[model samples]
Target: MEDFLQNLLNGIAAGSIYALIALGYTMVYGVLKLINFAHGDIFMIGSFVGFYAGRYMARHATGEAASLGSAALVLLLAMLVCGIVGYLNERIAYRPLRNAPRIASLITAIGVSFLLEYGGQMVFGPDPKFFPTLVEKKIIHLGTITTTNYQFIVLAVAIVFMGLLQYIIYGTKFGRALRAVSFNFETASLMGIPTDRIISMTFVLGSMLAAVAGILYGLSYPKIDPLMGIMPGLKAFVAAVLGGIGNVPGAVVGGLLIGIIESFVGGSQFSSYRDGIAFVILIVILLFRPSGLFGRYEPEKV
Candidate 1:
């Protein structure tokens, strides 16, 4: 039971990262009906941003606590940088293909993905860089299960960000406009909503979330490379699909489920197949219920 609890905690921590990235995927799909495959690369870029920011702050900080406090600033900078990158991605690569076939946009996204990966390698180098330890690590005992301060911190930050997102999506006027645009682009535009700006906002918001995820992920794993985003990105995509691709709440649920499942698998003898578990779940879910757990099927009008 103690072991089980430990694995569960571990699952939740990892799941928070997956959920964060998945939210980006779901939001973009909700608005554009297009997958920004380069989003994972945006995540990678955010990690590097945090890496440099954290390292620089650590050098100037007076103490461990001060260095840790710098994490908030690091997070803000990463969000701003990646947000701009996402905005540019939409404007330069995705906007032109809006009227074209879906395949064209998909191929363009893939092309962009390659561009970010190789471009990142050229810019940041192919070697893996160690993430600076911004937060001091301490172990906490909860009954029979032991956990770290870092895990709790990661979970807490993720929840805060998710709550803020919920408020933005459901509480604000801009959010109402965003939802309006997502529902029907032409109708929303006719209703005097600036559809283009809303779409750009969607990208900006999603990328910001991804940036936070990237920073949290770096804190957890501590090693990052240009290609690090690929696996996590794919798994997060599975989570999005599992929970109904365009459904916001569903993305969170799916992320937690996938994270818990992965943790359990890792704890067992089949640990070697931990990465493959996502694909298995993806295939199984696709076969049994293609619309996903929370998604209702809609047939095309002939």
Candidate 2:
């Protein structure tokens, strides 16, 4: 029982990161109907950004405030850099292909992913770097289960971001414009909505979420690498699909579910299969319930 609880806590922490990254996938799909495969790379970039920012701040500080405050400031810095990268992605690689076939955009996304991956190697070097400690680590004991404050920190920050996103999606003019653009670009344009800008803004919002995930993951694991985004990116995609590709709340549920299941599986003797479980879930979800657990079936008219 204690073991189960421990694994659950670990899973939730991991799932929160997955959910943050998955939001990027689902949101871009919601508006542009294009998957930004390079988003994972953006998350990777954010980690490196946080790595440097955290270290710089750490060096400048003298005491306790260095830990928490430094983390917060570093998070903002990473998000800002990643948000710019997301905007550039939309402006450069994707904007020209807006009127092109979906396949063209899809191929371009893959191209962008490759460019960032290899480009990251060129810029950040092809080696893994230790994520500098921004927060002092302490064990948090929950009865018989053991964890750390980082778990709670991850969950708390993720919730705050999700809440802000909910407000943005449902409580603002941009949200309405985004919804309109997603519903019908031509009609939204006819109604004076700047569809292009809305689409680009969507990418920025999603990418910032990825940045948050990247920083949180680095804090937990204390390792940053150029190619680190690949597997987590794929699994987060699976979570997005499992929760309904374009459904906002569904992405959160799917991420937690994937994380919980993967955690339980890893705790068992099937630890060797931890990485494969996500794909298996993907296959099962696709085969039986492509509409996703939270998604309603919408018939596409041909």
Candidate 3:
């Protein structure tokens, strides 16, 4: 029972990171029906950006204000940079391919993915860098179970971001425009909803979410590399699929579930297979319900 409780607590924080990355997958799919494979690279970029930003602050500032400023500024800077990258990705690489066959866009996304990954290694260095602590670390215990303050921070930040996302999707005009574009690109364009801009914004928003996830993951693990986003990004994709590819809430559920499963497996003797478990879930979910947990299938008409 103690072990189970401990795993559950750890899982939630791990799941929060997965959920943030998964949101990017679901949102991009919702808008363009294109899987932005470069998203993982964006996650990589965010961490690298945070690493440099933290170091720069360390050299220039001191005291309590520097501490507070570094945390906030690093996050905002990452978000802003990733957002612009996403925007340019859509505008330069994806926008022109909008009218092409789906395969073309998929290939282009793959090309972009490669560009970011290898390009990142060339620019950010090939070795892993230690992520600086943005906040002081402290351990917390519950009976025989143990956790850290960073876990709580990750969970809290995820909740706040997800809540903000919920409002953007349900309460704002931009959200409506996004939904409209998701429903039917042609119809939305005809209605003067600016489908192109909506698509760009979707990429921007999703990438920003990835940036937050990257920073949070760095805080928890503290070791980062250009390739760090690969597994988490893939797992998040599975999470999006598990929750139903185009459904927003489903992504969160899938991410949390995957995280819990990973935690349990990571703590067991079969830890070697921890990464493989996510793919197993992916295969099972696809075999049983391709639409995902919250998704409803609608047969396409010829």
Candidate 4:
């Protein structure tokens, strides 16, 4: 029982990270009806950026004085850089294929993913680097369960960001435009909604979330690798699909569920295939409920 509880906590901690990334997936899908497969690699890039930035700061800053408030600053810097990268990815790779077949965009997304993974290796080197542990404080403790400061911070940040996102989606003008664009781009354009801009913004927002997830991932594992985004990205996508591809809340639910399932499988079953569990669930969900948990069945208007 104790072990199960401990594992559950760990799963939630990990799931929070997945949920953050999954938001990016759901957002892009909801608006554009296109899966930004490269979003995960963008997450990877964010981790790398933060890892190097921390290392650089550590080397240059004086002893105690230098370390003062550096962690928060590093996180800010990482988020900014990663957000820019994500925005550019949307502008460069996806923008051109907006009117093309969905398959074309999907292929472009895969191409973009490869570009980032390989480009990262060439620039940062293929060797995996260590991300410096910025938030070293550990807080919150139970009988045998404990949460780290970084975990709390990451989870809080994810929740706050998602809350803000929900507000934007359901409350603000931009949100209305976004929803309009999602339901029907042509009508949105006819209504002078600036569909192109909304789509770009959606991609940018999703990318930014992915970047945050990357940083959180680095904090949790403290390792930097070009390929790190692959598994997490894939899993987050599975989560998005599992919860219903275009539903915002579904992404969160799906990510957390995937995280919990992976944790259990890894803890009790073969750890080697922990990553595979997400795909299995994805397949099962698609086989049974193609619309996903929160997805509504939309009949084609033939």
Regions more than 4 Å wrong, model 2: none
Clashes of each: 0, 0, 0, 0
Query: CA RMSD for every model?
Result: 1.0, 1.0, 1.2, 2.1
Candidate lDDT (C-alpha), each: 0.93, 0.91, 0.91, 0.84
List pairs with backbone clashes in candidate 3.
Answer: none
Q: Output the TM-score of candidate 2.
A: 0.98
C-alpha positional error of residue 265 in candidate 4 after TM-score superposition, expressed in Å: 1.4
Q: Judge candidate 2 at residue 116 and give its lDDT.
A: 89
Candidate 4 lDDT, 55-170, residue by residue in tens: 88887775555564676677677678877887787888888887887899899999999999999899989998888866555677777776666767777877887898899899
lDDT of 3 by residue, 1-302 (tens): 99889989888999989999999999999988888888988988888889999888777878877787788899999999999998999999999998898889999988998898889889988899999878778899867988888999899999999999999999999999899989898999898897888888999999999999989998998999888988999999999999999899999999999999999999899989999999999999999999999998966555
Pick the winner on TM-score between candidates 2 and 4.
Answer: 2
Model 4: residues with Cα > 4 Å off, grouped in runs: 60-68, 299-302
Writing each residue's lDDT as its tens digit, candidate 2 over 77-167 gives 9999999999999999999999998889999999999898899999999989999888888898888998998999999999999999999
Residue 289 of model 1: what lDDT?
Answer: 83
- Cα error, residue 282 of model 3, in Å, equals 0.6
Model 1 ranges off by over 4 Å: none
- Which candidate gets the maximum lDDT versus the true structure? 1
Could you tell me every candidate's TM-score relative to the true structure?
0.98, 0.98, 0.97, 0.93
